[model samples]
Target: MSDSSFRILIIGVLIACSLTHVRSDASDHRYKVGDVVPLYANKVGPFHNPSETYRYFDLPFCSPDGIIKEKREALGEVLNGDRLVSAPYKLNFRDEKDSAVACRKKLSEQDVAQFRSAVEKDFYFQMYYDDLPIWGFIGKVDKEGKTHPNEYKYFLYKHIQFDILYNKDRVIEISARMDPHSLVDLTEDKEVDVEFMYSVKWKETDTPFEKRMEKYSLSSSLPHHLEIHWFSIINSCVTVLLLTGFLATILMRVLKNDFVKYAQDEEAADDQEETGWKYIHGDVFRFPKYKSLFAAALGSGSQLFTLTVFIFMLALVGVFYPYNRGALFTALVVIYALTSGIAGYTAASFYCQLEGTNWVRNLLLTGCLFCGPLFLTFCFLNTVAIAYNATAALPFGTIVVIVLIWTLVTSPLLVLGGIAGKNSKAEFQAPCRTTKYPREIPPLPWYRSAIPQMAMAGFLPFSAIYIELYYIFASVWGHRIYTIYSILFIVFIILLIVTAFITVALTYFQLAAEDHEWWWRSFLCGGSTGAFIYAYCLYYYYARSDMSGFMQTSFFFGYMACICYGFFLMLGTVGFRASLLFVRHIYRSIKCE
Candidate 1:
């Protein structure tokens, strides 16, 4: 096809996709009644203001079969993606009295007799249709009835049922209609029982109830619109590219001059030699303090780096999304567990190279440094969530499962990695041998210090990714679906490149200034981006989002902190490796005898 024709065809495809995403009623996609469809309740307070305090709590009482069709706005067709469970409850549509009695039996005697609150509260039901949650208020309830004292009366919900017609393939037609009169009422005990009297047959028509049901699907997925911020991405990329080019040009020019000067000086008649990075080659590679700890961090960071890369690749390929619920979380947990071996191996190898003898201590520190803090933070946050009756809180069983995964899968792999790492015979090769004692480090100005270098290094990497970070935060906190994995993967690569380049530049400058303590500084310089990310998250929560309640606050900050820490480790490792290579290459270039 010609370029214009291709463009037109692409646009046509996008429009078609946005208009309708047809899916077959296959076993996996098809939902049945009484199959335990997940229901999320959004509780509203006085004046029906949505209490954005707690996350949706699962209501296991009613199994609702609904279709959550997400509109592919770019393509103009709706795609059927599953974000939530969509099985329906098998309600034996019998007499009202019998249905009520059956529902009453499902609840405890105390629950059936007692009321929750005196004032009526608005609880919205988030029905998972096609695995997408379409939230709507079902009914109103008052603990103390306005007319009857100590008695509660629940209002009934009346919504139109979407009758979707398909030719023979079970694919939904664009002209779908909503047949009015599907009713359900909440009893005094908060039990859900459908009103069989209000049920109706499939009413096929060209148009029913004002607009087509497809409009509702479009609106439902509106929040999750694929917003490709092209300008922001381009701006970020250009800025980072410019900065990278400048740093590379300066480093190359300066290094070339230094190499020429050193070579000329060495061949001169003068006995005295100049002092710089070359002069301290022996002490530069000397074992840093807390060697064991450093090795462990490096190992874990490496593992995390690999894990992130793999996950992003999978996401980009569409293997883990648009269908599976909780797949990402499950994948992360599993992958991280598997990568524990990598962590242990890298840490142990580095420690052994540093001539560390206490293997047990090294191993323990490697495992505890990140994981311990993570678990503790999660526990504290979970406790707070539980206390506040938040649905965001992880259940006891889930916690147990996570713990078991770590213990059985991760722990054993870590041990195996440690053993393998220890058994390896690789030598810690340095260009120059270290002296008996450490060199006396000279004092430098504030700008030349490690802290300042780290701050500068971190800012560059953060700047490269800050724009993408906003979208990530929105998707996580705003109940929006982000499907731009290709763009995200590109941005991720850019972030890595920027991080490595800046770290190398900063490390070289620091070393040139006679600062032999570049080991930890290099790591910190790259890792400090996490600090910036965390700071951004705080700003996002307070300034951008209208999120309230202790649970939401805790969950956001708590998980964000953990994520930032991982970011730190990953970037820090990148920085350290780049600097290490730079140091080795420069040292080897000089005639250091």
Candidate 2:
């Protein structure tokens, strides 16, 4: 063909392809009512407090498509017994006929007994599709009331119906509707029947999940809270900047004067005399007494720091698309196991630097300090969940998987990292040699003491993230969805900066008070922010939140303790590194003889 003819032909082909693409996009597949869809239970929560939620098993119902019908789990399957019984659901279309309901399987005496036990424990079921909760129910059935054993009181859903639409053999659409009765009195056991009624119809929609979410999931003001708190966040930023500026100015003036004094002629320098931190320069650089403990903490802190950064970055970048707590938790566990090398290296290197010889002991203790506590706590929590038959309890297979991750992935990485760190040399260099005997620390005033300094230093770092904490708390406890990774990232950075600066300032104050024992103080000062965070959590639980179940309460406080401990490690590491740099710079600048 000629060039002009070929070009014309190409244009025609391109046009046809574009048209086909548009048509394909516009005519996506449609779903029918009888076709069973996967019903995900993202997390189960108490009625009063949705924020405190736990992951549970999903439920599958039988539905028919054009060609096939999906089968439900076996009646004997004990999956999510708290929310649903294992008995098969026999469908009925009639609403008024008791015989039709009676045709369906009635709860056996054993089933009734188990169900009654679950209801007494306040167990409820909430169904979620896509990332939103669609249906919620409590096992409220008519049973003998405690007030009057002779009379029966209704407890569960008084009216339950499923609206289904089918076209010939294919089921096209489905939705659930229910009118729940007053809270059931479960104090007494009375055998009861469970039944479901259905109404059939047909409707088509482009976005089923979105439509369902709108109809079922109650809208919350969590986003509004995020927007409203922007001013307070900005205020916190400004306050942190001012405080850092003041601290920087004071340190600069003091250090500059010290440098000038030390730079003087021999006679003049002698007359001025090295005082405060300068007086104990030889002892300040001395390895702390609990070298093994220090090394272990530093290693764990480094690992947690990296994990925090990685998680925030992933969230900010939308890697955690659904942004559910379960996903976040899984990612953390996997990442932490992978990052064990970093933790091992940090601890081993620091321990070696302190001229300690117990490499194996240090590595073992390091792993135990953080990971051991976490594992123990997890086991305890899991036991509690199992006792309550809470879905949050991990299955045996999942527990095995976690153990394998720790033993195979984390443990090996720790050993490799410890070996590497032991082999490598640390860059830290002290201008003055450590003295054999420790310098006698002078008596300090109340304000200059370690407790006062730690208490005061922690507040600034906490303040930096206080505004953001509201949203974080809501996401964890309330039905609020957290998606602003950018905001979280910014807050994390601010927290780091505040922690470092405040810790340095506190260290300076302690040293100036003629205290040479700054090794632990620096870590404590920054790590203490976790204490404040825990305090705020208590305040939120008692004063700001509506959470009421003992299970939720236990879970919240239990997990919060672990979270705060990790926070302590991260912040403490930042502070210690900052203080170390600050001390090194001051000594190096001064001609310490």
lDDT of 1 by residue, 1-593 (tens): 13543353344333322323332222343333223222222322222222223322233333232332322111101011122232232221111121121121243433333213312344444443333334544444545536664455554444333223322221222221222234333455555434322221222345432232334334324544434356556866897779888987998899999899888888884476667787677689988999988998898898899779757855766544432324565556666777777788889988999999987788888888789889898789767856865444565656677789789878887887788888885688788778777777788889988678778988887887787787778766765456667777878888888888888888888888777889999999989899999999989988888776565677678878999999999999998998899888888888775
Worst lDDT run of 10 residues, candidate 1, spans 72-81
The C-alpha TM-scores of every prediction are: 0.74, 0.77
Per-residue accuracy of model 2 over 247-298 as CA lDDT, tens digit each? 9899999877766665664446465566767888888898887999999999
TM-score of 2: 0.77
Candidate 1 regions with alpha-carbon error over 4 angstroms:
1-123, 129-132, 138-228
Candidate 1: lDDT over CA atoms?
0.62
| Clash numbers, per candidate | 23, 15
- The model with the greatest TM-score is 2
Residue 200, model 2, lDDT: 30
